[model samples]
Target chain A: MNTDTSRREEHWQRTRKLMFITLTIWFIFSFVVHWFAAPLNAMAPDFFGWPFGFYMAAQGSEIIFVVTLFWFVRAQHAIDKDCGFTEED
Target chain B: MAIIKGDFIDNLPKVYLMYTGGFLGFVLLMAIFEQMGMGSDTIGILFVAFTIAIYAGIGWLSRTMAVDAYYVAGRQVPAVFNGMATAADWMSGASFVAMAGGIYFGGHGYLAFVVGWTGGYILVASLMAPYLRKFGCYTVPDFIGTRYGGNLPRFLGVVILAVASFTYVTAQINATGTIASRALQIPFEVGVWFGLSGILLCSMLGGMRAVTWTQVAQYIVLIIAYLVPVIWMSNKQGFGMIPQLVYGDAVQRITELELLHGMGTLDPVAGAKAGLKALSVPFAAAGDSWQFVTLVFCMMTGTASLPHILMRYFTTPSVKAARQSVAWSLLFIFFLYFTAPALATFTKLQILDPNLATGIIGKSIADVQALDWIQKWSNVGFLQIIDANADGILQLNEFFMRGDIVVLATPEIAGLPYVISGLVAAGGMAAAMSTADGLLLAIANALSHDLYYKIIDPKADTKHRLLVARGLLLVIGAGAAIVASMKLTSILGAVAWAFDFAASGLFVPIVLGIWWKRANRQGAIAAMIGGFGVGTWYLYMIKWGGMDIWFGINDLRFAIIGMPVSLFLMVVVSLMTEEPDAETQAMVDEIRIPTGETVLKAAH
Candidate 1:
């Protein structure tokens, strides 16, 4: 994997800021939202007769993580390119 | 260049042959009895007995004595075989059982375990392993001492290694015990003893040679144990398609039942009869917004910190080999990790309601697994329900949230023969024992490699150094066995804090050390000690003794606060100090060069 040095550097600070932002979003959906929602939705919606809270708490994080890693990998790669160490093998 | 001298060693045929013979022997015996309808408990006992026999057999076969044979298999393991051992080391009790449980309990937040576990290898390959291999040391502290030119840095590394390894081992022991009790119907203490004995045999008698092959065998058992249930679940569903078996009828039936229950129309146990409603909502709520940032940061960093994972590079012959090994490990790991979600959905469906399809369990066929355990587990609240309206049976909404049952439950859901249950039990024990041994051995090696070999006696020759490592392995193994006896949280829960501790401390300095020419002894030492100190400190304040409220927030999120501070102090101090001398710079140059010749040169 070639590091595309010609790739323009986005703001170094800007990159960190965006990661921080996305990371924040990741957490809310994970620990905070699920923790509070579990008790609140006790016996709530029945999708296919399944509790919504159960699905999210058990299965939801996987999707978010896929997205999170997708974002993180791309973002870090871009930063690496800008910083000039793009030789990814 | 190493590009030409690279070689493949193939002794695994002997090992794999042994593995196949053992597994096949068990499968045949278990299947015959199972088709005849043996009870679950008998199968469970068989499972425990079989594992003890196989582990002991391997120990006797290896007959490894000295530390070299024990530790790093004398650093003679072929890459592919070592990769297999490392994969087993990395998985442990927490990974095999607890990961599924976390998904069972926390859902998606637990996804980080997969990402962090796999992704950490990337950092290790790219950032640390190769160079460390060039340094050619036996322990992390040795590498630190040589690189930084100080006893202070070496001491710090040893401390960090011990603390991380000990805490992590606790969870592995804990999880193994849980699996043992579930499979064997024994008390948790008995199971803990089962786990401790395996480690004692491998670490105390066999050393790394015995430990390494044992781990490789354990990996096979674990993978098979996990998959057997999936295969059975799939087969029982017909054509063995897991997604269909899991998600096929379950979604519709559950949704309809839940909506009916919610509207007060469906029977509490059977789910509402009103057409199954669908419950689908996105997780897009904002607040003080959610704490997504910290979780990701913690995981990303944690991936970088774990000691067991980092230690694998020491076994590789070169830096490139180290990098390649990481890629290999992830590729192997994904084989199991990819199956998790499907397992989650399928198990949820299999157990969606109290009474699963009677046709399957009631069939006039053989191998009936008494799900009395399911009701028993549910009674303990590991499994549960609402009985929303008090119907005699269970409804879809009754599926309870438990953080521990998923892996243990896999065999039950698949309706595997009791002998298979025994195999799965053995597998779970394997995961727990291998992980515990790895951590214990690392702690032991630090005592010898870092303390006695490098610091106290540079004068000590190879024989003396070997003796020291063997002695330390015994001491550490006994100490850890004592802890295993006590029992603790599930492996994942106990180790989760360790990950947070590692992420903040071990990840940064190690990563920085590889790339930064300006990373002086002062900066490197400061980064390691500071990163470990502050990381441990944050977890200590928040997680230890259960007193974790910092400024009104839980401590897991704040663990990474130390990472940035460590990074800062590292850079600031490096800039404030004199640059590395010519000898040090030359050493770095040699490590960076991708040639076996240079390595040979350095050896001379």
Candidate 2:
């Protein structure tokens, strides 16, 4: 029981660390990029015809969000397996 | 007993795949009927009726008396299908109907809604979904009641759920009414009843079992409807097949056109009539970056906290599935979110560019009014063209179109066949009805399960409990429809308020309940009451009571004030109060790990 509890604590710590990292990336993409969107758009001529700020706000952020979610799932699953915390199927 | 047999559950993928193919084929048949000279009205009615009939059929087939099936669909939903259902549920009338219009008018600022909403699932997947699933409660309130060990917190949970979901559902019903009225040429007031009846037919019988399957079907229809016109418009405009990737040029062109038409300078007549301004300019419609950031924050937090959305994860088969399901939900939703900007840009191009076949700018008023699509939409009061200048030529300032009609009118605007219009109408109805079904179920289930069964009468058997739930579903749904008919608020405005209320009241309590073991019942109660109360007070004051807007937080983003209060009170109060007993702490630890069976399974 003690080992089990310690294992659960370790698993949660790892999971929480991963979650914070993912959310940091999420925040940067969602808010930080959009906050600087105007400057990004001004630099559009250098980076293809697409307005980088507008594209990120409109399309690019959504794609990253999707990828981030899937990646989080895979990473969390791996943590669960490593900690012997995978649920019985 | 539920009708969902083991074999049937195993074949969900195959079954839904075939259903999608069959639905597309049906749309094709409608297109062929259009070629055969069928009236557009008849085609529209056929599309609406056929899709509703399928939902009603699924509701009938999946009708269940078992408590587990009724509340959580036997907890057997696969991750992918649940994700699709959630996407359908999340994409309400505000999303399918008004979002593109918002993007068109508000420009880059409104993408806040899109970003915040999708980003919310990240919070759900990491902080909430799997933990709640492992806790194994049927309703969100069940988690609150169990975790907090009291009825007050549970009662407050139900109240918050009802307030938020009821407000949200009315907006959806309003959207359904708007779509149905246009499609069937009925009055908006009467169309609401039609929409409500269809919503009832799907959720009243089988509960979650019915709603889950029907929502999956709705997702397929809505995505197809949403994608077809954008793709068609893209190809027609020589932008190639992939509109999502190719629309940057169109956005740039739209920016140029806005300047050329003096839209950047905002005509008083255009501003007063339709609120039209620069379409592609960043931060033009949202007033400034502060409002944009706050709006995104409110929407994202709201997305994580909404009871109906959180309930979707409870239907998944296991904790693992719940975590994965949030990703699927975001992915399916991403399909439409990524396309909305493209649709907005392409439609604006069609209106502004005189070279395009659908462009009406600088055209003779008589000629533009004679256009079939304009005539139809104007007849419904969604579109209006007047020779205000009396020059006989329709200037851009003389044209007025409601943002609500943008998506529905896109097919017609791009000069697509009438069949596509009908399909889009069906899609809009699917989006509205699916969301309404979920909200109605969420409200009804909270009332019956959390309030009545758990608090009012614990002795009530499963049959009695479910009956009360179904009865509440009928009552609450009709009540929402009545409120919707009054048109008290714009669909998007009401949705924004719903999110604010949910975010302020529920987000802190629920998140802390899982993560913070010291979070006692006092803290939970304080957070719920303090957050919700302050938010409501702020909204009432700013919106009606003539209160000053504090720190630039508008009525719509009142949660900005409430959420911080809730968090502050929760942490402070939790520290001031005694920590929860060891058993509850153990329960939290157990929920943190995904290896065990659901803790509350036997209790239910």
Candidate 3:
């Protein structure tokens, strides 16, 4: 009983942390990165011959989004396993 | 509220063929028009009678209509039929009329929109559908409120959904007016009136059943209407060839490419320094950078967020059906999508190819004039051209900024004739009308069902809810119609913003709340508030707050911010707050699995 309770609690803690990280990334991408579009555009190219501002707007947010979706799935799946949440259940 | 049970309406095939004589008349006329090289104004006189006949004459045949009849075709819609209906709901006039325009106008840059809209479905099917169906609510607000166990989040969602939808519906009305103005030889606003009336009648009379059936029919018209012209023009131009050649030296060197690119908002001459070959605008940059990235993000997420699209999922029989239906929608939509890029490529070549332009109209057929096909349309602001050096050679590079005209003008430019143009106009209006009415109805239903019935007047009777819904419809319909007439921004632009708000604000909370067992009331609330607040502020900044430069980018990034914050806040708040009770936790498990086979788990 104690082990199961501890496992559930641990799963809860992990989900909580993950959501924070994901959202923070989302917020930064949406507000901070977007808010700084002009400066980034004014800045020099980083990698891949793509301009910084242009790259951020064109592909960066999408990368984050793809990452966010996959991350959410992975995080949730881990918690589900920790809690013994099989589809069969 | 659950679907009201009915006998006859329950077993009706929601997607059964409705190829009546009246509707066929429309198809036939559209066919003739394509052969004749005509426009679409004739659709008004022809199909107006058919539309009215169906509404009044055929509508009277059904005496057993109920809320079940009105919404979800009594939830008896087969998955495949529902898929077709859903595709119609998804592919509006802006998409049909403007997608090719994006390709024509932006070259390779705007292809992101084509990919973004289609890709968004993967998320919708995976994340949103089955779970929402498991809860089985009448409207979005009900699901949000019930999930959160409060009215605040529901109200907030209602406001957001309303704002997003109003902005969207206005654009559809604008498209409707475009059809009327072009077809009927009247002001553009005249078309809006006809379009608005069609929407109002379909919505008020059919409820869900009427809308669903009409949408399916309209979708058929829209697709056929588009294909007839393209194929007909392609035939004369040569099978699978797009360049339209006439009998006599092709009377004029018709410049379609110049017309396509020249239609968008012109950038400052300084911004145009990249040369006439490039463009920079509110949604994209001159040289093509990251704006497309955000726009795609917003569009993809926005798809899941769009109220009209979500409303269709509720029509499914089960959660699994909802998921599967989305897959079907993607498949059906793929047909049009696959063709669109081809059309764009062909149209671009058809217009820009020096060989086609010069040979057909330039060399042999010189000094041609007098046809409403060319002159009148150019007069009314559909097509444009620039002979930069006045050397008689039209430059294809000039049309770098045209908005949504490729789909709008493709038929006419292809020489599909006036009647085909009329059908295309009707199809565009149908796309706009079907989706627009659904949106307006959603807002009204949220008000009537969520605000008035559930929140304010908790004990309200059935008739009162219906009355409120109908009343709100009238007010919302009129207001949105008026807003539609404004035409200050591009329809595609407004729709994208709505999708972004949905993606960043609503989709995260709604999907997680149902699927993720740990998602709690606090998390739902936090996610909604955080995402919606930031997303709104982001749009407000661009629309009203005036961040047109420096930090300026597309509205999609703003949405990207909101979605993450919302998801993050939801998690943090859920953890910090008290755990769910065992019963609530069990409900969460049930909402996810919904197979009724799993043993109940502890809520906390």
Candidate 4:
């Protein structure tokens, strides 16, 4: 019983940690980039003809979001397997 | 016969692959017919009829009387297919038809919708989808009711789901009406009936099973319809096949064109009409960054809380699949979101650049009005030219077009073949009808499963329950159609309000029900009523009663206020009241792991 409780705690901690990291990245790309869009547009060079902030808003953030989701899935899958918590499908 | 008997259900990938091939072949045949001098209107009608027929056929194939299949598609959908279906379910007429138009008009401020919506899938994957699946509820209300262990929370869940989803479904049906009116040359009022029947034909038969399979097919058609014209336009403009990357140049070109057209300059005659902003400019139409940020936040939370979207996860095969399915959903949705800005840039370029063959802004009014595409769209009241200055040529200010026509009219605007126009209209119908199907199902299922079966009569048999669900689906779908014909609001506005309502009311309770072990029934009920009531009240006050804008949050983002209120009340109430029982806490812990059988299913 003790081991089971510890395992659940460890699994949850790892999962929560991963979720935090993923969400932090999500927030940065989703909000932080857009919030600083004006300065980014002025400071950074054109990216394949797009201003930097516009690229992030229109294309770059979406790409990063997709990558972050896939990364979370793989990482969470590993955590589940390591914790012996994967579903028996 | 053998394939229909069982093999078809087993080989989803194979069947869908062949279906895609068959659909493309049909489109090719239509193209040949156009080449052979088929009438454009006939071709348009055929395209709409054919796609709806295919959806109906799929509905027939997947039709089921079984409780599980009707409610959750027997919980056997693979992650990838569920992702496709969810993509179709998520991308309504707003995303498919009006999104590019929004980007074109609102500039960078509107990318909030794209970013917030896709970013929402991240929330779903991490916080909601897997746990909800593990809880194993047929509807969002099912989860709320079971977790809180009462009928009041369940009833509140049903009410919120109905209101939000009904508002959303009406928008989708309105979108379908717009497409149908254009395609069939029918009145918008009559066209909504066409849209409603197509929606009901699929969902009223097989329920979620029908909706899931038909949505997958619709996703394919909509993505193809969206991509074909944009790619063709890009290649025509010497951008090659990779328009998503190359279209940045078109945005730059449009910015130059805006300057050339005297974007910020004042001319007394055109000053009233100069609402066009530079394409790449940030916070131009939004007035400030705060409004943009608040709008993004509202849409993100709203995306997470939408009942029809969350219900898609319940159809996946397992909890693991649910998590992966969200990722897949985002990926499928990404195809359209990433392309929308490019589509907006290119379509605007087509209109504004006087050097292009498709350019209309500087063209003679008679010539522009004589164009077949212009005449057709104008006849439907979607496009107009006033020549406000009595100038012979059409100025930028003289042109008036509805955003809803942007995607549907893209092929015509780009001077692509009429066949492509037919294809785009069909795709628009698919987008609208698929979403309408899902929303109607979500509303009806909550009524039948949560309100009727769980609350009114727990002893009701499965057959009777499904009968009630199907019957209610018919009634509710028709009600929505009637409301849609009334045109209560613009498609995007109603959709935004729907999201705000869902986020304000449902987000707190659902998230807390998962993560917070001590969330009592009192907290849950308080959160739902308090949040929803606050959102509705704020919306009414701001939109009609002339209240001042709080924190620069507009009527579209009333959730910005309601969500915080709900969160505060929920935490305080949960802590003040008795904690949930051990069984409920254990169920929460079990859902978190995703390894055990579904708790609610086992209990029932």
Against the native chain B, what TM-score does each candidate's chain B reach?
A: 0.84, 0.96, 0.84, 0.96
Candidate scoring better on lDDT of 3 and 4: 4
lDDT of model 4 at position B578? 92
Query: Candidates' TM-scores?
Result: 0.76, 0.97, 0.76, 0.97
Q: Kindly report which residue stretches of model 3 are placed more than 4 angstroms away from their true locations once superposed.
A: A1-89, B1-26, B29-44, B47-65, B68-71, B237-289, B357-372, B398-402, B548-552, B596-604
Instruction: State the number of backbone clashes in model 4.
Output: 0
Alpha-carbon deviation at B150 in model 4, angstroms: 1.1
Better of 1 and 4 by DockQ: 4
Backbone clashes, each candidate: 41, 0, 35, 0
At residue B336, give the lDDT of candidate 3. 64
Candidate 1, residue B505: lDDT: 58
RMSD of each: 8.4, 2.0, 8.5, 2.2
What are the per-residue Cα lDDT tens digits for candidate 2 across B1-604?
3335668888888888899999989999998899999999999999999999999989888988999999999888999999999999999998899999888767888888888988888889988999999999989999999999989999999999999999999999999998888788899999999999999999998999999999999999999999999999999999999999888778778766666766645443443344323233432222366776788889999999999999999998888999999999999999999998889889988988888778887777888988988897777566777676588986656677777789988988888899999999999999999999999999999999999999999999988999999999999988999899999988889999999999999999999999899999999999999999999999999999999999899977999999999999999999999999999998998899887778897437
Candidate 4 per-residue lDDT, tens place, B1-604, comes to 3443465657988888999999899889999999999999999999999999999888887888888888898888899999999999999999999999888777888888888888988888888999999888999999999999889999998999999999999999999998898799999899999999999999988999889999999999999899999999999999999899888778778777877765656232432222323223322222356766788888889999999999999988888899999999999999999999999889888988999989887889999998988898777566667766786987665677776678888898899999999999988899999999999999999999889888889899878998999999999999999899998898899999999999999999999899889888999999999999999999999989999988878888999989998998899999999999988898889999978778877324
- Model 1, B315-352: lDDT tens digits are 76555456556556665665566666456545654543
**Candidate of highest DockQ:** 4
Residue-by-residue lDDT tens digits, candidate 3, B239-353: 4443211211111112233343352443323322221332222222223346645665677788878877887887776555665666667666655664564455455445444
